[model samples]
Target: MQSIPYSVTLRPKIFVFTVMGTYAALAPIAVSSVFQHLLAVPMSVLLTMVSVCIFAVAWIMQREETSFKALNRIGISMILAIALPAFLSIAASIYALTVVQSVEYVAYFQHSLLNRLINIGMFATLSLLILFFIQKDVRKVTYSLTQGYFVGLSVLVAGGVWQFLHFTIGYPMPGFETRAFVHSVSEDVLINFRLTSFTDEPSFLVPFLIDGLIIGGMLLSKKAYSLYAIPAVLVLLLSFSVSGYVNLAVIVFSATILLFARGIIPKKVGLYAIISILILGMITVLIFPQLITALFMPIIGRLDSLFDVMHHSRLYMLVFPFVWLFDYSSINALFGFGPGSYDFLARTKYLSHQGAVSGTSNNAFIDLLFEHGVFGGLVFICVFIGVFVYLWRKRKGHLYNSIALLLWIHLGLTNMYRSDFASPRFWIIVLIVIGLTELAKRNITLSDRRASSSYKKKVTT
Candidate 1:
């Protein structure tokens, strides 16, 4: 068959891939180009600008049909899940002001409301535009997104390795002073003496790395990607992020079991995984003896204190919202206060006794409940379950679908330590997963049609 000549569609496809690819590539790096310190803008803001271009260029070109009806059930479900929180936040903010008549609380509530609205707006806008691009061409978007993200991750992992080497052998790296303006809190990262790479914190770097592992697993068969997994694992260890370790352990363990149960992996695969873990552990201990006390001890202490309210600040933040909820009206329990309201709630109600003026829920699950209320939070949860089930159903004997499922799982697990929804990487992964699902559906439909046509022709013959 002669190859079809390239046409006008080629330009739009190139533009879409470039914009989407650059957006994905920039997710892992947190520092912005223009500013430093107190006035520093995050790279995410720049990414948002990039997203607008995606909408503009696509709108101007009008080469392909775009409509709300183009959205699949999964896409529509996510929009609703996000919309519920924004709606509840507005309603709850109004209700909260009426109940707590303090001028101080009003100021805080307004601030929180505005920020939450922005977060919701940003998430919705990015999701919709990306969904448009995905709907335009699923295969191109899928390949570009996955490849672009892996490239960004590779750069981040390389930076982590460089940081580790500099710390270990005095190999002269750039001073933290240079990164201080870009990094959110350089002092905290400095004090930890762990590898953070280009991210603001060790924990902040974990999610991207976990996603890298997910992508690496997904593309291992398609590309020579397995080699990159080694340095990624090393960098994960070097970060000494407890949340990273915990999330990785859970994901790897659960994935291993699921794959085994499905016969995707033989019994020997389990044994091999065990051996790999032991070997990696032994190698780390031998090379980085400091991890025994620095990494493992802290992990042990944190886990041991997991239930202790005073000792575990994250746990305290997670559980304390309910304290204020119970003190307020029962209706507040159903809808909570509002988005961004947690900061004020934390100050006056949750941690007022300690004289703390600022705090965060830290846990996204708790943030959803405390800010948006139980009803809104449950809406988001239902969306997650729906996406998981859809992906899981399609995951069997499908590599990209399996990767998409794992990534969705990663998002859930990573949120245990993070609550911010406006992050570009989070949405990038979400869009990629959605694209993969849609691509798989399209391929399967075409496959069925082809088979049916063949059957009809055979019968006529």
Candidate 2:
């Protein structure tokens, strides 16, 4: 057997464990209704500290030095893309302190400002560390992440099954007692329990499962263990989240196309697989008619609502906040209200008469506009466009880049319904995609240089 180097083994393990540990830390564990801080808060703090330490080690171990000109360009881009938005966030908070009169609002704004600063700082620090260290062995890092995700998916499926059984049997497992009875939109209509398993909510659980499906598909296409994706798909179906279903459809379609195009699966087998899936799906629906309804009725209902603007309050949620922001004074219009101020506005102004719904803007761009103002929103838009441009130019033959593009597209559509930035898992996936894309760019540049050098040497000879 071939032996692996200690550094090789150790580095990938560190990367994998750091990624897994961050996910674990961010996993929501509901304790008492009011004091649910045991795992989520403390683990998050520990993960942040560990991440900082890892960044330090990665910086010290960095070997390759990018050119000064390249570094300068990257530095300026990073400053504008990351630093500017962070500065705007802080500035908005300070401006809020000067203008806002309520103590409660001021305290909320300060807390939100602190949160944004921490989020942006962590994102920038970790991104830089990954760019510096993990870029060299991105393949290894992605493999490690795949392995970790497989384990996580397995656990989630087992727990989801157990939770479903508990729901059906009216008995809770010891030590894994039912945390909450989460219900989907379909459940609200038909009165059925949705599976959350160990996660805090179905909404949270679905995104992780969707990510698992995407990564698992990528791995499977590379001839890694693909069967693990079955359970992930199962759990996602059980979650019955409309967004989850949509994401699953997108992933399956994209993966199928990519795999067929790459000749990973023969045409005959691909056709057979599709037929088998359709037949099995029909059989499953026949066997569990109620289950099918529970899984898809909500999605259909949501789709139906898109045509009826008056009935779908989501449309209002998207437009009213921007209107309200525009109505503010020029300073507020330019810098906007501080973070969490929109939620306050939503509660006091919008939802007070609407009913018991929480005061969320529901749309990420709208929320960004409300919290960070026009300047911050513009900066964010510019950063997004930059990333998309890079991906578009470089994603031709790269599977991961294509996957990242698909994921970003999904995020864009879904963020119209809910802000993905609020989820830690969302940021983790984004960072991984960014790391992979950057590595691809670096590899391509190196290849081009080698090719040019070889051509010149041959001509001289």
Candidate 3:
């Protein structure tokens, strides 16, 4: 390891790790980059490697700099939070499988224990590293808002462009090919010429993209952010998924409550603002019924079909998993089922023609429950809620809180794209968000401490 004066502060190590963390958060772009050969591995795998490497290198660097260790306890906590459940499952899974039959019966170990162990060891090592580095970031108000908007919009832009080229023009980037095949014209999505560029024949990208833009819009106080809603809402309406409207309703309500609560604007302002928007919206809907119907109403029809499938005992999709969720005999319930396990089950069902197939799980909570079980679900949700509650309470008048609230909103949407973590861009933005939040907290705490100390000195003097 190279050494410089402690005064220099290993900013490079911090920066490099931060980049890697960001890469791990945004998956859409990363997946495309992987197939483009701009990167050597799948973006998903690369994200893990980057996270793992950063932790490893940062650890080495920390050992060489004693003073830095004092500040790195944050990193240690991140690692534990991420890795503990994962590694525990790895050990527990193996033990459980061995009991049912033999070590050979465990699918992950069928090839070689060394390979399985290496994966486990890597996850454990990286998770600990993250725990050491992460802390409460103290972000200034305007800066945090800017960072949130940047991140929120970055994802929207990437996903939108990718979808347009793939679905509308029939030009699929190698990574985006599956989308073309799945959303083919037979799906009934090509009704309007202006809206088809979204690449999702059924308009899945609409809600995803608009949801992000909505977050950005909420953080924006000026007309600049408000103007963004026109295109975003339009695209979302076009997605033809009925739930997109539900998503819009939820996002609007969430955003208004969040923005108003933060003193970004007064609650009375929000009420008047909502009344004005509703009145204007009604006028527009009445005058331009055809246009609105073409874009937004199309998706609403899909709701009945979706519910129809669920009603016919698609309960297996939502229910069968509970057996494993509670089964003490399986390693899944206590520690975790591990990442990608439920997808594996769903994929198997697809292959057998027993389940309706889509790459994404329809529900985020259910998806989480199936994979990580009670403990993992609790930790993940609690962390999310804790972040929100802490932001709402501790940080007054910060845009990052708006962003945090939006991310939670995204998570709250029934089906969060789990693979989101694979994107470098997404991770970078989220990393900054988290880091900024942590930094801001520390600044406030230190400021309070100094003030207290000064008062004591004055009293003594």
Which predicted model would earn the best lDDT? 1
lDDT of each: 0.69, 0.57, 0.48
Whose TM-score is greatest here? 1
- Candidate 2: global Cα-lDDT? 0.57
TM-score of 3: 0.66
TM-scores, all models, native as reference: 0.82, 0.72, 0.66
The sequence of per-residue lDDT tens digits that candidate 3 reaches over residues 1-461 is 44666545657554644554354334333344323355564445555676677657756766643343454332333334444554665565566564545332355334433443444455555444443455312333223334434554555554555555555677665443323332212233334332322233323444345545744543444575656655555545544444555666787677667656656567787788889999999999999887765444334334454544444233345555666466545455766555434534544344223444443355555555654566766665665556557656743534444555565455456344222222233333344445545544443321224224454333212
Residue 296 Cα positional deviation in candidate 1, in Å, after optimal superposition: 2.8
How accurate locally is residue 13 in candidate 1, as Cα lDDT from 0 to 100? 65
lDDT ranking, best first: 1, 2, 3
lDDT of 3: 0.48
Candidate 2 residue pairs that clash: none
lDDT value, residue 152 of candidate 3: 41
Task: Give the Cα RMSD of candidate 1.
Answer: 6.6
Q: Give a tens-digit lDDT track for model 1, residues 1-461.
A: 23444556577668777877777787776442322233454557656766776766775677566678877667668877867676866787688777878776687775757766776777777777777767766777777788888888888888888887887788887765322121222222222456777666677778888888877665554345567778888888767677888899988986886677556678897898899989998998899886464445434434565677865566677766767765676667788777777777655753423545345676667777777787877888888888998888877744456667888888988777864665676677788888767866675321224225454233212
Residue 127 in model 3: lDDT: 40
**What does candidate 2's lDDT look like per residue over 199-235, in tens digits?**
6556656666666666555445433435566656666
Question: Order of candidates by TM-score, top first?
Answer: 1, 2, 3
